[model samples]
Target chain A: MKKYLMKGNEAIAEAAIQAGCRFYFGYPITPSTEIIEYMARKMQQVGGTFLQAESEIAAIYMVFGASGSGKRVMTASSSTGISLKQEGLSFLAANELPAVIVNIMRTGPGLGGLGATQADYFQATKGGGHGDYRLIVLAPNSVQEMTDLIMDGFDLADIYRNPVMILADGILGQMMEPVIFKEPEKIEIDKSWATTGANGRKRNIITSYNLHNEAGEEKALYLEQKYKGIKEQEQRWEEYHMEDAEYVFVAYGTSARIVKGAVDQLRKEGNKVGLIRPITLWPFPEKAFIPLLNRIKGYMVVEMSAGQMVEDVKLNVNGAAPVAFYSRQGGITPQPEEIIEKFNNSYHKGGEQ
Target chain B: MGETIFSKTKGLTNTPFHYCPGCTHGIIHRILAEVLEELAILQDTIGVAPVGCAGFIEKYINVDFQGGAHGRAPAVATGIKRALPDKVVFTYQGDGDMASIGTAEAIHAAARGEKFTTIFVNNGIYGMTGGQMAPTSLIGQKTSTSPYGRDSSQSGYPLDFPLLISQIPGAAYVASVSVDTPQNVIKAKKAIKKAFEIQMKGIGFTMVSVLSTCPTNWGMSPIQSIKWLQENMKNYYKLGELKTPEMLNQ
Candidate 1:
């Protein structure tokens, strides 16, 4: 294994190549441009293809086409660029294609500046595109995790025959950290369904629901079964100081890293504050809340956005324990003291339900 | 044994076409499938079907096919051809799909010299979505959207797509032909075959536009629709091989 100090965006490119991805199509946007540039430079040396598409819509459809051709393909974009990609994403999902997409998120309802924010939790975890589909969204808190999860993303996409998204933030995208590359586990996926050509056997037709197509209802039912299997199988998270705690802070990605600072300082001051860092944002690791709900006093959801993940926390927690939310907006990270103050202001001390 | 004079090409599946009666799209599809079978690239070909009346092309085509978003068939074809360079790839698009909504995808694919063939069908009206004004609709044509007949100032003149594509330096072959009569259908088939042949030789983008008819949308009988395309559309969009690889060599 070789170690290199690389930006989060650049690490994503290198990791995807190591995972046997040979096709990349993308349009440049801030916090995600390095991913494309890195791919362009490395793809040439790796006997791969890299194309800067005319638009985000073109890039994703190219991904759709390439994936159908039995190749591991990828595309990266920011919040606004990802918005432009929604139509193709819907098509990718409807067609049940496997491709890795990255959204190095920037703050936005629309063009929310070139700064880091976790405002896209709803878009990433819930459905951004118009359809009843779920993207296996992985939120990486550090550059190392970002590199490792991208490799995992490709495998999961191929296994499930669905799209996987790396829901990263601009801060981690631009930050530099040392990452060690490891050999990827070889996974043999049955690509007999791909649209290579009709050389020997019967032809393969890749399509979705159409007006004349009468099998759309059955297709939707089949997809629901696959989603149900995924939810039961993949739920990932990290619990810090969770063995003995009264109040838990639920966060993910950059927001979780910030919340960790508060967890440590609050523990030094004799406060039982813990952290639950969700990795798989779509599956959401609701099981992490179950064991803590009986003994814990309450839960506090910390985020860089207003209050998105908190609702999910409350939904899972039910009425067992109260849930409080704390946040900063517009590319702001609330300090540890501020997080502690919000915690103190919201809930009382002493591990009591 | 009796000698058969005519048979459906093996390049198409047993699935029947869903196009309306008196529409020339059926003729164009048969011509393309015949070309694919004649070239013996049917098994190696991958087609990207455009959104429109051609959206169900996958059901009818025998070779591998991928459905495309509206106006994005060329881009989809680009992806397939680049991924598997040895495989033959093509796109089938309508005037509303290629000339109007998908102009950027079509033009950029040609500009980038993507190695693929495109079958462009020009019916002078939007057929699938009911009779509406298209980019190829004539200056005075009365469509559903253009009820008062198209005013050049309001709806703009018919866009000549092959002429526009031929001007691009990356395009190696472009032809505007028609299937109005039996003789012209043969000529149109020849043009389609040439376009696919150019793609096999690793030439840049190649396209053949077949002037077609839609009697249902044009509010005319099938014979009148053919006459209208020959008299009105033939004058607006000239017929010929607008560009060829030989011309590019020159």
Candidate 2:
């Protein structure tokens, strides 16, 4: 492993290249644009493909075409751009095409500010595109995981033959941190089932087609089974100081970074505070929090949206303990001190415990 | 008179097409397939079929095919070509995909001069969706939605894609052709082949606008639709190669 200081967006782009991504297509949107720019410059040197698409709609379709041909492809966009990509994303999901999409989230009900926001939690974790489909979402809290999960993202995407998302925020995209690029893993290109030319073989068909009612039902059943397998096989989380801790600080991506800082500060004041940061958002590590229910007094969910993820926390905790929400939206990121204050207040009030 | 009825260029395919009767899409598809076969690049080519009538083009064309959203075929083709430059890429698009929702993608693809080809079929009306006035619909042309002839004063004027595309510096070739007659069909094939040749040489964007017949939309018989295209649409979208790298070679 080689240690280098890098921004989260740059790290994700670099790791993608190292992990054998051959195409990057995206539109210019704040917080996510840097990732596109980085790939645009780097992909050429690596003999990969890079394009600044006409719009997010075009960008995602470009990804579909490249991925359809069985090459590793990717795209990066923010909330508004991602919204444009929903049409193509639905197509990608339906076709079971392997692709990587990075959403450096910004605040938005519509065209909100360019600052970090987790308001896209529903859009990213649930089915944002169309049809009954899902994207495997990875939520990284630090520069390390940002670099690490992109490699994992590509692998998971290929394994499932599905679109995988790195759901980050502006803070992660913009903030500079120490990152280590692990040794490049060599991967073999598999074209046995790929839609390369129809040379001397039966033409390989890549489509999301349900010609009849029975076929549609079967396709839906197959997809549900795949999702269930992913839930069992791919749940990842980081439990920090949860043992004998007073409150569980539940967060992911950039919010988790601030929560970590808050937990450190609160510990200096002799308060027992810890964190449970989710690395994979879609296959949420519910089992990690389930064990903590007996020991933890309460759960405080911190994100950049208005209680988008708090619902997940409540469901996981199962009313064993109360869950409170602390949010910062419309592009403003909650500071470490503000989160600490809320935690201290919650602990003192003892309503959640 | 002893010449082969089908062009020597088309790839081998066993199944019949699912297109509507008297549709010109089959002719256009055959022209593209023939061009690919003649260039000896059918084995190295990928085609993106857009939404609307051509959504099932994969079944007809023997080459590798994929589908994109209504107007985003060019964007998807751009991605595929850029990803694998050695592979020839093209998009088969209709007026709806090229002019309406996908206008942003289409113009940008040409402007950027992406090294690929676009086969644009301008049939004056959106045929698959009953009859809607397309961006390319002629002024005073009537459609189901436009009960009265299309009034540019109310609805926007018909967009001239070939003229607009010719203005982009990145485009290496731009042309407008029609499939109204056998002679015109031959000219359209040449235009299509030239576009493919430009891509193989790594030249930037090339587009061919094919003026086609829409019998159902025009409220006419198949032959009358052909006659209408020959008499009316040809004046609006004149045929011929506007620009080509071959000119530079000459």
Candidate 3:
């Protein structure tokens, strides 16, 4: 367990190598390009694959091809590039291909600038592509966690035989922090369900083409059952000083880090503040937030996007407390001090509900 | 490795291939199989077949076959090759799959010099989708899509795939050959073999364009289909090596 100072992107690539990922296909995009570059340099050393695909579309399909062959495969892209990958992602999900997709998110309705933002929350957590499928979304708030979760993402992907996304932000990708790169535990490769080019036994076919209506419906139902099981097994969250606190700040990823710092400072100032950091965005810890709702006085939903996760929080809270949102758009990361100020402002002003 | 490799391509199980009588897909498929045999890499090879008439090539090829989206065989091949460099990878694509819908995928694969071979079949018309005008359709070639004969004022002239591929620095070997005659077919087989050899040496992207016969679209007999390919298509798409690995290293 040697600790190495690494940027979030580099840590993820290193973690992937440790996790037995031998295939990486990606196209360079802002913020996330470093992830691809890191893998590109490291893959050669490990006899792994590194391909800079023509586009995000091409890159993801390569992910499809490799993953279908029962290999640990992955691809990374930013917001706009990820948007282009929606169709392929849906196909991957529908086919139940075990692969990882890292989205170092940036702001975008279209091509948003290269800055940190959590604008992809809905897209990541709520089936970004046109399909009734849920990708296991892991939100990492630190470089250390980013590395750890990338390994976990691969395991989860293999376990569920589905795509797992590390819905990270540009801040996380660029920021450098000390990380202990642990040698990954040995895991057996499973290809019982994979389409490894039809080697005699039952002709392994990997496809999402369910032309029969009944067959498609049945597959969709089975996927729903898997999602339900995942919801029970994989929901994760962190509670910061919520035991006796009134105002609970809800956030995740970089926003959670900012909100955590804010809560730490506000608690010292004698204001009752706490943070709820969601690690798994898809199986959002709605139940964990339930115990806090009755104890908390007010809710400040701090995010880099405009009220996306805030809506989810409000819906979960269900009027247990009034919810206030503090957000910034187009790649701006909300500062710790700024988030603290919002918390203080709302706490002092009293109820507007 | 010394064992002769049989042709991997076959007609669909329980159904004959939908190709026109004497369509060159069967010929090109055999050439690819022959090359894979000569290289002794068929057992470890993965072939990506693109959408079009040849989209169901996965059914035909006995080796590991993965179907790719139209024009995306190259990209799919890139992935499979990159993931498993020890395994030989190739793509069998039709003109529509190689030229029109997938130009970007093809160009980028070549530009990146991905270590894979692409066997491109050009028959001047889209055979799968009821004989539509394809990218390689000659100027004024009539099809369902270009019923009035392709008017250059509206439709672009036929694309020269070998000429285009030659410009790509990443490409180690590029040649255009025809399956219209026995001699030309033999030459085509040699070209396919050479392309695979370049990939085996890690010589980057290799592509061979086979001018094929499409009797149903050309409205010709099997013999006339061959004759038409020789007379008209061959003149437009001359059979020769556009780029060789030796030329590239120099």
* Per-prediction CA RMSD (Å): 1.8, 2.9, 4.3
Pairwise DockQ winner, candidates 2 and 3: 2
Q: Decide which is better by lDDT, 1 or 2.
A: 1
Candidate 3 lDDT, tens digit per residue, A1-353?
A: 68899999989998999999999999998888888998889999998888777788899889988887779998899988999888788878887888999999987888778888988999988988887999999999999999889999999999888899999988899999999876666667577765444445544445454347999889989999999999999999988988788888889988888788888888898988778888999888887887776677788898898779988899898999888889887877788888776766676866332
Worst 10 residues of 3 chain A by lDDT: A195-204
- The digit string of per-residue lDDT tens for model 1 on A1-353 reads 67899999999999999999999999999989999999999999999999988988889888988999999999999999998888887788888899999999988887788777889889887888888888889999999999899999999999999899999998899999999977888999999988888989888989874663457778888989998888889999999999898989999999899899999999998999899999999888988888887798888899889888888898999989888888888888777788888888887554222
The candidates' interface RMSDs, in order, read 0.9, 1.5, 2.6
Candidate 3 lDDT over B1-250, as tens digits, reads: 6886754433223335656678888878767776676666656777787888887766555577666466777877777776667777888888898899889989999998989889988998889878999989998888998999999899878889778988889999999988777788899889988888889889889999988888887898999888887779878986799999888877
Residue A38 in candidate 3, Cα distance off native in Å: 3.2
* Candidate ranking (DockQ, best to worst): 1, 2, 3
Q: Residue A128: error of model 2 in Å?
A: 2.1
Evaluate candidate 2 and give its CAPRI docking class based on DockQ: medium
TM per prediction: 0.97, 0.92, 0.85
What tens digits encode model 2's per-residue C-alpha lDDT throughout A1-353?
56899998999999999888978888888878889889989999998878777778888988988888888888898988899889888899888899999999888888888777889989998888778988899998878888888998998898888899999888888989999888766666565666677777777666664358998999999999998999999989888777778778999878887888888888888888889988888888887886788877788999888787888889999998778778877888899988876776777766442
Please give the range of 10 consecutive residues that has the lowest summed lDDT in model 2 chain B.
B5-14
